[model samples]
Target: MFKNIKSTKTLVKKSLTIFLLAMTAVMFSSVAMSVQSLRGDSALDSKANKAGKHKIDTVEGGIERNFELQPPMIPHTIDKYRISLKGNGCMKCHSEKAYKKEKAPKVGDSHYVTRDGKTLKTISSRRYFCTQCHAPQTKDNPLVDNVYEGI
Candidate 1:
């Protein structure tokens, strides 16, 4: 009976170790895959050289003109935005205070409105998710050419 108990303990320990190792391997592989995807050569970067020397407008242009217009294309990729909430990274340059200092465009007024229709003087907790409305600009040419007359 003692021998059987000892063998059972050994089996449990082995099974636990195997499970732990398998989990660790899966975690590591997942991380590695993510890293590889991020690092893989971007076709866009290579094509950047082929792009015309036309000067494209940036968010700064919209600020200069006031937020009456859609801002220019963002120069950099915003793919890392999914990692955290507070660190949207856009707030680094486009926040209220940052806009004052950098003369960049301040976050829009609509961002201060709550879902319940209350207008907060500052960005409301509900509006903290930047990506819900805002999107990163890309260099790709538009697929359809249409006259979009604004109302």
Candidate 2:
């Protein structure tokens, strides 16, 4: 009975050792195969191997025919400007009352005109959003050569 118990213990220990060794071998083999596959043959390398000659050019904005040509782009940073139905940063300068004090050019009269050609005494609610027409002037190089001629 003693001999049988000892043999059983030995068998269990040997089985556990074999299971652990098999798992370790599987993990190492998978890692080695992935490393071999990734060596010097990635998709990024294939994309960078392309050969081409590219040309760059300067591009300008469209011609301005309107007298109030969008205020020559917002001269100052508008990050702090408030834009809401109740308040707008543009009104501080362009409004009838504020324009005189701020010395900023008032919004164009045409903006107050309705689609039916009726001009309102004040800025129309639909045209109150200043950024809708005015954009910040950025100093960045053009991405492509534009041959567009505006009317």
Candidate 3:
């Protein structure tokens, strides 16, 4: 009967679909088991390397940037300085009013400009954190080979 034939055809189609799905799952699971990262079996949560023990260099002037538009490096150590929401010790010397007396470089003029393009009398709140852009230099060797020449 056509009804019997239709029922058998439907059953066979469903069986073939289930078989194909099972095969695809097996292939994907095998590929997943064999694949690995460059870090090997190390866990995602664990650190890949230890922290460097070298001290930051206190360059007399400043470190020359290898690339243009690089943020100027801090010439001195910042161990004694404190930067917090309430106060920034760096502004004591680097502020517009004190840079001349302190003989320290003035904070960049761009720091006075707000995100809205309006220039403010004081340093913009967005640029208040000095260490966010600038960092002290270290005399330690590079982790990888350096072939870069100054631009």
Candidate 4:
């Protein structure tokens, strides 16, 4: 009985060691793959060298909403927007007080409501970040055909 107990302990130790070694090997291989895959120029760093001087489309009206839930595309250039953790430059034009004066559309009332349905005077923290949903429009044509039509 004592011999059997010792053998069982040894088997458990061997299994645990093998499992730990396999986990270590998997972690190292994943880290190596991630490092190798990201070793290239990022897409954003590549400028429009072929598409002439990259200019923001500043046409007066905004583009059509792509689908039912699509956020409106930015109508004007936002290259100078200081959208950061410290301050939101977009609020200068889109905030309640400034929207009327600037003729820019006010932020939606939903922005002031919490997920639990409580309404607040200020934009909820979840919606405080504007560009999270809205994106600036690019002049480039779609890479693939968009067959979607909004209702």
Per-residue lDDT over 111-133 for candidate 2, one digit per residue giving the tens place of the 0 to 100 score: 78888888888878777887887
Q: Write the per-residue lDDT of candidate 3 for residues 53-78, one digit (tens) a residue.
A: 66889887677887877778898888
Top candidate by lDDT: 3
Compared with the true structure, the alpha-carbon lDDT of candidate 1 equals: 0.62
lDDT of each: 0.62, 0.67, 0.84, 0.78
Which residue runs does candidate 1 get wrong by more than 4 Å?
A: 1-60, 63-83
Candidate with best TM-score: 3
lDDT of 3: 0.84
Clashing pairs for model 4 are none
Error of 4 at 21 (Å): 39
Model 1 clash pairs are none
Winner of 1 and 3 under lDDT: 3
lDDT by residue (1-151, candidate 4, tens digit) is 9999999999999999999999999989876555522223345566523443445677686777867667788888887988788888998998888999999989988888999999988778888888899877667655445787677
Off by over 4 Å in 3: 1-52
Q: What TM-score does candidate 3 reach?
A: 0.63
